[model samples]
Every structure is written in C-alpha cells, then in structure tokens.
Target chain A: MVEVKLFASLRTVAGEKGFLTDAASVGELLREAAERYGEDFAKRLQIATVLVNGKNIAHLRWKRTRLKDGDVVSLFPPLAGG
Target chain B: MIGGYMGKVLQVDLSTGAIESYSLPERMLELYVGNKGLGARLLYDLLPPMTDPLSEKNVFIVTTAPLTGAGAPSSNRFNITTKSPLTGAIVNSNCGGNFGVFLKRAGYDSLIITGKASKPVYLKINEEGVSIEDASELWGLDTEKIQEKLTAGTGKLVIGPAGENLVKYAAVFSQERAAGRGGVGAVMGSKNLKAVIAGGKKRVPVAHKDKFKDACRKWRQLSREHPATGEELPRFGTSIFVNKCNATHTLPTRNFLHGSYDEADAVSGETLAEKHLIKNIGCYGCPIACGRQVQLHGKNIKGPEYETVGLFGPNLMNADLKAIIELNYQADLLGMDTISLGNTLGFVMEAREKGLIKTDLAFGKIDRLSRTLDDIAYRRGLGDDMAEGVRFLSQKYGGEEFALHVKGMELASYEPRGAVGQGLGYAIGSRGGCHIAAGYPIYLEANGPITVDPLATTGKPGLVVLNQTTMEAVSTIGCCIFSVYMFLPKALLELNARSPLISKIVRSTFLYGGNIIGKALSWPAWTLPVPAPFFMLPQVQTHAHCTGERYTLGKMMELGKRVVSMDRIFNLREGLTGADDTLPKRLTDELQRAEEPRSKVTLSKMLPKYYNFRGWTPAGVPREKTLRTLQIEEEPMLPQTAMGAASTV
Candidate 1:
C-alpha cells in the first residue's frame, strides 16, 4: 500500500487528506483516486503535480512510474510569493 | 504614430493650483510607453536635483499607459511615482483598481502633482473640468469612509489618515485597492493634499484598430487555456498559493524566521474563499477576477491578500482569520501598507521577547498588534518607534542582527531562508525591497519549470537584473504580471506577427505541439508589455475564435527599458550610492535556524555579482558609461558634493 497526500486546491477536490492506494502504477493510482473523488480531481491532476519524498513527480516518469510500499506521494498545485 | 496611443499628458500643479494639458511628446510616449516608464522620465525631468522626498520640491505622479482602460485583459494597471521617504530612493508603486482606467478616460496619459496644497484639499477631474476642492470635511476619515464620500463615478483615488499623517510606509488607495509600498502617501501628506476624486468619459484612443481587436480575442483564448492562471488564480485568488508554499516548506512565518506556518490552513486562499468569501472582484478588464469580498460584520470588506495572509497571519504569529481580516480592514482604512506594518510589528515583538524593549509585545499578542498599529498611525507611544520603520527600530533596540528589511523597507512575506535569490532581489531592488520591482528569483526557484537550488546565490544576480529590467518595461506598458502565465502563448504569436525576431524563435519549436512551445516561451515572455486594469485597450477579443487588434513588441520593450533606466537615474539623483543598496543585518548575519529550518542566506556573496550584472562598478555604483548610455547624467557634483555622507554602508 502507498500513502498519497493532497494539499491546497487539490485537497478541496480530493475531499480527504491521505488515502491508501494498492495500485502499482502512477496512472492506476490516480485513476482510482479520481474515481473515489470527482471529475474535478482528474482535471486537477493535469495541473496537480505529484511529489515523492519532497521531489516533483514530473521529475520522474509520468503514468508509467511504479509505486512501492512505504513510498510517500503528495499532490500540489503551483504557489508563489515574495 | 497611427497605432499606439491616447496622445495626451495632464500635469496638475498643486502649488499654483494650475491644470495644464499637453499632447505627450511622441518620442517620449514611444520610448517610455506609459506607467512605470513614462512616470520615471517625467519625474526625472520635473524633479529638481536631490529634492527632499517629503518636501514641497517633490512631485507625486499617477500615470497610465496606452493599454489602460482598454478591453485588453488585465492591462489596465496604473502606477504612482514619487520620491520615497522610506529609503529616499525613487518610489513607484502600482495598484489594480478602477482609477487608472478612469484616469485614462479623463483624457490624460498621466497626472503630475507638484508643490504644496495651501490647505487640506482634494483634486476632482472629470469631462467638465478639474478643480482643487477643500477636503477638511473628509479629514481623519478612513479609506472606506473617504471613498464613500467621493462621487461614485469611476476614477476616484483617495488617501486616508495614514497618508494624511505622513506615515513613511503609508499607501495611496483607490476604491479598496492600494498603491501599497514606497511611501507615496507620505509624499501626499507632506504636500497637504487629501485625495484625488476623478472621473471621465472620454474614449481611450487605440493604434491599429483592426489588429488590436483580433489580438484581443486570441489573448482571451490563451488566458482561458492556461491551467494555472485561467483556472487556479481566477478560482482561488492569490491566497491559493498559501497552501502550495506551506506544503513546499516555503511559506514565510514569524518574520521570515521560518518557512512553514503551524496554522497555514487557517489563512490559505482556499480556506478564505470557502469560509469568508462573499464575492470575487476584478480590476478593470481582468478576466482572472482574484480580489476577495468578505463579510466581516454586516458590511462587506476586502479580504487580506497573500502577503497579508503571510505577514499578519504567520509573521505576527496570529492564525485566526477574523483577526487577520479585521487588521487588514483597519490597515486599509488607515491607508497603511499592511506588508510593511506587519513586518515592522514583528520586529517589535521579537525585540520585546529579547528584552531589547521593556514591553510584552510577543507573538500572537493581538492587543499589542492593535496598540502598535494605532501608535504607528498616530505616531504615538511604541507606535512612534514602529513608525520609524523596522530598520531604525532594530538599530535603536540593538537587534540589528534580526532586522528584516532591505534598503530600509521591510521585506514582503516570503522568507529569504527558503530562497536566496529573492533575498538578493530585495537587497538590490532600486525601490527599497519591493517584490514586484524584481521578483524573478522567486519565480525561478519555486514556480519555474526549470530546476534550481533555491538556497544558493549562484545565477541569482543575472536573474534579478533580468527580472528588474522586464518589470520596468511591464510597469511602463501598464500591465499586470499575473497575465504572463495565461497570455504568454498568445503574446508570442502576437509578437511573431509584429516582429521578425520573434518569428525566428517560433519556427525553432515546430517539433513540440504549440502547447510545449507555449510553456517554454512563457519564461521569456516577461519582456513584453503586460495588460493592466487602468489602461484599457480600445477593443479586445477573448479567445482564438475572436479577433483582437495587434501592437508592437519592439516599441513596448523600448519603453520598458527607458522606464527602468530613468528610475535608476532618479535614484542616482537622490544620492542612492552603492552603500544604499544593501540588505538588513538579519538576513546577512542572524541565524534563524529555530524558526526557519533551512535558513541560509549569504547576501554578501551575491551583492558583488549583482553589481557586475547591472554594469555597475565593483563598489555597486552605476558605471559612468552605463549611466551615460541610459541618458542619465553623472550625479551633478551634488552641490558641494557631500555624497554618501549619511550612507548606511
């Protein structure tokens, strides 16, 4: 099982903070999460970036990236301030 | 000549109470563009050598660009330019409101105010005429009340008690929006001017009517296509970023001593919108509609922006939304810059904790914050100390190591610990720690598609310089930077249509569908003229399906460069030597490890490189050659040449 955490606007769509996902692939995980959430969650995923251990998931492979037990995944949209 | 402007400049002399109208010199308009650029040139020309910022010698200008009040999306922003009482540098602060668009409709590209008003007075301009009216009745009133007393017609800009009292960090407000930084309000107070009530119905003139209309439609489509700006910003507003920043551990807290706040959710834009939002407000022709409307009591009020959420929310150690909202309202009413005030108050609280002062003004102390604000606005008790600004307070109280400021002005909400490049921008900004003046480092570090070490000083100098130059141009052209994300792809297509240089680049990206090139091009799109609220394009289209008119990029960049260089010249004239461009001691020396988990700022390492990148001497002085190239004369020997005598460095 993998733990996925959603934040900011993504959380508003995800409804819950953390969820358990047994899916092995990133795409399957997202598809399952979106099914439980709403169409907005799927739409937000296009802009909603995934972070693994504080690094962006875009830095890794997209849907093909495999998930492992104990791996922490976080979803976030862009936020900037100065 | 045929396709770019409204063609008129309005000069109002408060001293003699004279109103003069002139067709703006074509060359000046072409080169300076409007807002930041034009205002700088006008101020450089009009201001006497080394004139006191708060003296009768200073001039306060509100300027708009050709794009103002047009149907162009987010292109109607206006700027207020003056000498700053805070850092004694050239101060130009812009705000998104109805005033800029109204001012453009009043048939003037700019309004230059000089001399002292004989008494408490306000200036009213409309299609009929312009007059200086007595405003004793409006004195001591807050911004909401003052704005209420004015004619409900479009284009009224007013100052509140903070400006009237000459608070150094006071701001000039229009409706609920404010020209928040640079002490523009203090200059108004110094001149005994109360407020400016203006409205006009003149149509904004356009260049290239056919092309501009087509361009507008394409631009609108581009905006709707961008996921971040078109959807996110419009839905959640800037406060939406609050959660993102906190999640990344970059949300500034407790006077930038920390990057993440304990109660980030309480002040997040999502929370604000979900809990308190009554309505969403848009500036001029903006499609994003990010402004917040919240009900505090029975009356609706403008909610705290992102900076306010960070500064008053976490920086002050206060998390309750109601407290932040009330304080935000109070500051707005007082015409005070909430960012500066909150930062200053944080310094006081820290000082008190250290026993540097004999007060109990600790973090989360709502009473102290309230008392301090009243004091600063009225220049009373501890307020007098706070009014001296964070830097002076630190100096007097012996906490110089923890003073959170750059060039005397306090830093905005983002903690430098999370991003060193932003710290560099603050230190080197021409307008004393302004974020918008040059905030590229933050973009490069956190929001960019490109990856960079946020805590490193490398590459920051060049980045800061590039952002500053671009911002200077954008300000002059009179547009909001927020539109850059949404409008960039369209801007590129428009530029290619206008200039061959842009076409060559567009052809190189044939491999990636238009969208990939669109994202890549957004990085460099900072160079183009941005659309603002005050200056509206004559006609604008919203999507690819519609036809908007076209404008030239070459002309816009030229005007932007002119505005940036002119402001530099103004600062040089004001005696801002290399010594004046410096960060506060806190960022330079104090270790904020407890609050800021990853705090590491070495401003000393970057200042030299910044100077080099700016074509300045090793000492950080603008090179004589660079100044001459920019058409800025050498400092004129400073009368008896007592230059750098009072320099903090």
Candidate 2:
C-alpha cells in the first residue's frame, strides 16, 4: 500500500487529505486517483506536481517511475508567496 | 495632468512648520511614473550623499502610483521611501491599506516631509487644507489606539512605541496593514511625527474611462480564473506555503541551520483556517481576499503571514502555533516588523546557544516571547541589543559568522540553502535582505509548481534579473506582489504537469536560457515596443487606459530596470559598494545538510554574470550607457535650504 497526500487546492478538490493506494507505479497510482476523485480532481491533478518520498518526480523518471509498498506520494498545485 | 494623478505633491518642513503644495511636473511623471519608481528618483535628487538616516537631513516620502485609487484591484497601495536607519540603504516599503486611497482622494499624489519637528505632531489633510497639529498626547499610544483616537472618517498612518523608541525594524501601520521593513517608522520617529491623516471626497479620474473600465473587468476575470490567485490564495492565504516549503526543504529552520522542520504543520495555513480563522480579509479592491482574520486571546486579529510563521515557528525551533499567533499580534500592536522581529529572536536564540551572549531566551522556549517583544519596543536590557537587529548584535557579541542577515537587515523566512538563486538575490538585493527586493526566486527554484534545480547556480543570474524587474514594475504600479502569481497561468501549469518533455523544456529555458533572455530584455525599450497580450498581464493595458499613455511590455520592463538602477545609483552614492552586497557566513560557508555538499549558496558564481547582464560595471554600478538608454538622468544635488521645496514651502 502507498500513502498519497494532497496539498493546497489539490486537497480542496480531493475532499480529503489523501488516500491509500495499492498501485505499483506512479502512472497507475495517478490513474487510480483520477478515477476515484472525478474530473475536477483530474483537472487539478493535470497542473499538480507529483513528489515521491520528498523528491520531485520530474527529477526522477516522471510518471514511469515505479513505486513500491509503503511509499509516500504527495501532490501539490502551483503555489506562490514570498 | 494624467487622469489618474491629482497633479500635486505636498511638502512639509517640520522644523519651520511650513506647508507647501506644488504641481507635479508632467515630464517627471511621464519618466518615473509614481510610487516606488518616482519616489526613488525623488530620494536620489533630494538626499545629500551619506546623510545619516535618523538625522533631520534624511528625506521621507509617502507616494502613490497612478493605479492607486484608480479603482484597480489591489492597487490601493502607498509607499514609504527613505534612507533606511537599519541598512543605510535606500528603502521603499509599500503597504496595502486605505491611506493611499484617501491620500489620493485628498488631492495629492505624494507627501514629502523634511526636518525635525519642534515637538511631537501629527498632520491632518482634507479637501479644505493640511495642518501640523500637536500630537504630544498621542506619542506613547500603540497603533490600534492612535487610529481610533484620530477622526473616524480619515485614513491614518501611525507609529507605535517601537517607532517612538526608534527600533531599527519599527514599522508604520495603516489599519491592520504595515509598511514594514528597513525601519521606515524609525525615520518617522526621528522627525517626531505621530501620524498623517487623509480624508476627502475627491475621486481619482481615469483618462479613457470606458477603456479603463473594460480593462479592469477583464483583469478581475483573469484573476478569478487563475488557480493560484483565484482558488489557492483565497482559500488558504499565504501561510499555505508552510507545508509546501517544508516538503521542498525551503522552510528555514533553527536560524537557517536547516531547511526542514518536524512540526511545520502546526503553523501551517491549513491548521490556521481549520481551527483558528474567523474569516478571510483583503486589501482595498482586492478580489483574492488572501488576508487571514483569526481569533487570538478572545479578539479577532490579523493572522501571522508565511514569513512570520516560518521565522517564529521553525526558525526558532518552536512549534507552538498559538504562541506565534499571539506574538504576531503583539509585534504589530507595538508597530514592529514581524519579519525583522522574528529574525532577531532567532539570532538571539542561536547566540545564546553558542555562548556568544548570556540571555535567558532559548531555542524552542515560548513563555518569555511576549515580554521580550515588549522589551524590544521599549529598548530594555537584552531587548535593546536585539532591537538594534542582527547586524549590530553580531558585531558586538562576536557571532558574525552565524548572523543570518545581509547588509544589516535580517533575512526573510525562506532559507537560501535549499534555493541557491534566492541566496544570490538576498546578497545582492538593494534594500538589504528583503525577499521582495531580491525578486523572490525561491518561487521558481523550489516553492512554485514547475521549478528549476534548487541547488543549481548556472542560470540564476538571468532568472533573478527577470523576476526582480517584473516584480519591481508590479510594485511601482501599486499592485500587490501576489498579482504576479498569474504570470504562470493555469494552462502552463497544466502543460507542465501533463508533459514531462514540456516541463523539461520549460525548466531548461530558465536554467540555461536565462542569460540570453536577460541580455535580450536588457535592450533599449524602442527595440521591443509591443505590449504583451492582455491575458499575459492586464497591468500594461490598465496603466495605458488610466494614464492615457501608450504603454508596452518593453516600456514596463524598462521602467522596472530603471527603478532598480536608480536605487543602485542612490546606494552607490551613499557608500554602499559591491563589497556590501553579501550574505552572512552562515549562508555562504555552512551547508544545510552535512551529506548534501552542494546545499550551500555559491553567490560568487552568479553575482558577476548578474552584474554583466544588468549592464552594470563589475563593481555593480549601472554603466553610463545603460542609464542613458533607460532615459535616467544623473539626479542634481539640491541645496539644504531648498530640500523640501521645488518652489517654496
């Protein structure tokens, strides 16, 4: 099982902090999230950043990066402030 | 006269008790615009070189932009510009409050004050006239009480005991908002001025009313559609960055010794909204409503912003959110700047830990904070030293190595070790360790959604210039800095998320193409005269309509560059050389994490390139040609007697 976290507007759309997913890859996990949360969440997710274990996936293997059991994934929408 | 301008500047000489009003030169208005930009020009022209900031020689200006009181969203901002008592640099501190609106309504665009008052006094301005009234009774009052004591219908700018006592980081308060940085209030105290009240029924006119109205409507719509502005900011406020900054390791912890905090969530905006917030507040004409109104000690007060939370929270190793809230309120009531106040406390805590000073304050200790804040305002004992800010403390207490400041002013809450470009910004920022002045590169480096490598130093010079120029322009026009959030629209964010290839391209453009972009943009305004699309930034169109002047993106960017250059020239004349453009040893020499060898900021690698791109000499002075191209003239030295008057006062 993987723990997924949502932040800022992503959290607002998700209607909860996050959920547990059993998906094996980041792409699969995101797909599951989209299906469960509906279109608004999916649209927000489209602009959201995905981080695996505190590392931005863009620096890693994008969505193709594989995930393992007990891994934590966090999603954040574009945010700005001083 | 421009449609947005009141066409007059009020000049007051406290020493002589003389008040004069002069028409603003149309040429000067066209060249410098207003507020921060025009104020810089005025300060440069009026101030003698190296005048003591706390002395009567220092010129103090309160200025408004054309957009201010022109019915533009979040445009009711006024700027306080003067030589900083803390940093000895030119400081232009802007505040979002009703004072600017009412000041414009009272038939003036700016107020120029000079000389020391014979005694404590306050100035009251109305459609009828302006007067310098005795304020002896109002001298010791706190910010909240003084405004209430003043006439109800007028808008006020008041100082508290902190300013009266001349705390280096004392702030000028207007309503719940503050022009808080660089000890602007200390300058006011030096003048023995208590408050300035403005009230009138005059309306700010627009040049092309129909066009201006249409632009404003579209601008509001654009703001509403942007996710960052319309949703995230409105719902969560700026404190929402706590969790994100923590996750990104950009949250300053333990006086910037580390970047991550264990208890960040306790002070997060989510927690504030969920448990403490009574309602959301906003500045005049602001649609985002990003301000927080939270219940503290049975009273509803302005909640702590992100910087306050970080500095008072993780930076001091304290986790009590309640303590932070209360301290935030106490600091504001005392007319102290929370950013500087929190940083000072963090420095003292670290100083205590290292045996650099003998203080009872300890890291993570909460009980004495409220009393300590009071002590600072009154300049009592150790609080007196603390009131002098980190620069003085470091000099006297032998902790300069760990002093988390730049050029005298303390750093804001964003720890630069996690975002190295921000480190560069802090070091070279004109008004000391100001994040806004430094252009806030941490957004692109770490906190923003699509980011460059936080530890990378290669493309930062160019990126820093871009952000700095853009933000300077935005501030000059009296808009909230938050309005810049829409620069990266929802479509770009969506594209960044949807395609890794696109993200790579975007990130690469910033990381590698920064120099090319910066250099190209550094060209003369005539080379790029076209205005960017309204959707990209409605400010250009709104400005054009309001002033009935042709404004383009190039002109806007050029104005920003000129403003920055003008400030640099002023600082240079005041003896602030490139040598002073430096960060503390903590940021430069110490790595945040032991294992991450590249975690520290390598400022030397970026500063030279930044200067070159800015068309400045290697010593960081703007080149003659650069100034000429930007149409900035060398400010003439005004004689002492003529300081507060163009004609007479």
Candidate that would win on TM-score? 2
lDDT of 2 by residue, B1-649 (tens): 6779998888888888788887766777887888899899889888778899999878899999999999988678999999999999999999987899999899999999988898999999998999999999999999999999999988899999999999999999999999999999999999999999999999998999999999999999999998888888888888988988898788999888888998997888878877788998988778888999999768889998899999999998888888899999889989999999888998899888898999889888999999999999999999999899999999999889888888898899898999999999998889989999999998888888879888999899999999999889888988889988878877888787776788888899998998887887789888887886787678878888999989888889998898999899999999999999898888899888898899899888999999998899999989999999988887553344445353332
lDDT of 2 at B248: 78
Model 1: runs farther than 4 Å from truth? A1-3, A20-35, A38-40, A60-72, A78-82, B1-4, B448-451, B487-559, B590-599, B624-649
- Residue B163 deviation, candidate 1, in Å? 0.9
Q: After superposition, how far is residue B645 of candidate 2 from its true place, in Å?
A: 3.5
Q: What is the lDDT of residue B95 in candidate 2?
A: 94
User: lDDT tens string, model 1, B107-198?
Assistant: 77678788788789988887788889998898888888888888887677878888888888999988788999978998998888888876
Pick out the ten consecutive residues of candidate 1 chain B with the lowest summed lDDT: B640-649
Against the true structure, what is model 1's DockQ? Answer: 0.32
lDDT for each of the candidates? Answer: 0.69, 0.88
Steric clash pairs (candidate 2): none
Q: Residue B117, candidate 2: how far off, in angstroms?
A: 1.1
Cα lDDT of model 1 by residue, A1-82, tens digit: 8988776667776766669888897778878878888887776665455556444444336566688998777676543222
